[model samples]
Target: MRCEIPILLRCCFCFPLRYGLLVWAYLKQISSISFSTVMIIKLCHDYYRIQASGAVISSLIILLMILDIAFNVLFIISAHKKDYKKMRIFYRYSIAVLCLNVAIVGFCIAMYAYYVYVAPIMIIFIWSFMVPTLVMIIVMVFLQGYLIILVRSEFIKLKNNSQFEFVNHGADEKCTANLDFVKEIPGTV
Candidate 1:
């Protein structure tokens, strides 16, 4: 996660590496591209935001997305400062994202069922609606689930590495050895 390798670091680099690329893509597109131009890269991302704006989990999804941006920044800073301990904040939200993505998958399956029931024959209108949405949701579900697993594995690995102080006295140690302590972060929330 950091150059020259900070003292504290991720046991599984893929989590941060994946999100780093996502954050970079978000920044690059949002800064330099017009909405129309951005669509080429952000097709599914924009579709999720716009289409799900009124869905039941929209608020949570929006909150998680916004929070993810913030967390990615935090991860960058913490990684630079050699504070993997602080990165533990992602443990909860990663699971939430995974669950929400599964919910979306369920909703898409239901949508498909209704569409097939209404029209056993091919329908362009519903095809247009279902194909992209289903594809996007399915992809998100897999990605989110893998991310959840990666985050959990990283935290579990952290639990024993005393170099990061992941182990502490009188701790519950459920998921992350009860990551109940946070070293103060400079210019961080």
Candidate 2:
């Protein structure tokens, strides 16, 4: 089923067995560069300094992605199971949480962008590596929540529409059946 694919991908992302292999490749590439080359030296220095933290952030993002995927899978399954009432409630809560997340991400990104581009004239700490990393982490967190909410809301809307259609169809069928029965009866008039 289409729902199961997301779950499998979620498991893979959570464990990150594939990501580990990608990191290993990057490490090998770094190691292969000759140290005697000046460009290689600069590259190695920047790579080691920035990429150490980047790896941690990337791992966290991947984990959150897995969670997002899992939530989507669950939402799809729940909707398919005819759990419309619960799905609607879940969707409303998800929207609220996602809106909060979007606000936080927007604030963090704005602050970080200003710090990077404009804050140098006004503040010293804003330029620090830690601030940017923290902002990035917050952004990733918000993004994951936002994605989950989007998927859940979409599924909820679709399921609700389908439920309405099903009910309407049943009613139409019953009406037609009643008309057929009435016609078949002996005329008393």
Q: Give the alpha carbon lDDT tens digit for every residue of 94-122 in model 2.
A: 56656756676677667767766765654
Model 1 lDDT per residue over 118-185, tens place:
87675567788788888988887776655555545544444555355455655754563555566975
In terms of lDDT, model 1 sits at 0.57
TM-score of each: 0.51, 0.33
Candidate that scores best on TM-score:
1
**Model 1, which residues run further than 4 Å from truth?**
1-64, 82-84, 119-122, 163-189
C-alpha lDDT values of all predictions? 0.57, 0.50
Candidate 2 overall lDDT versus native: 0.50
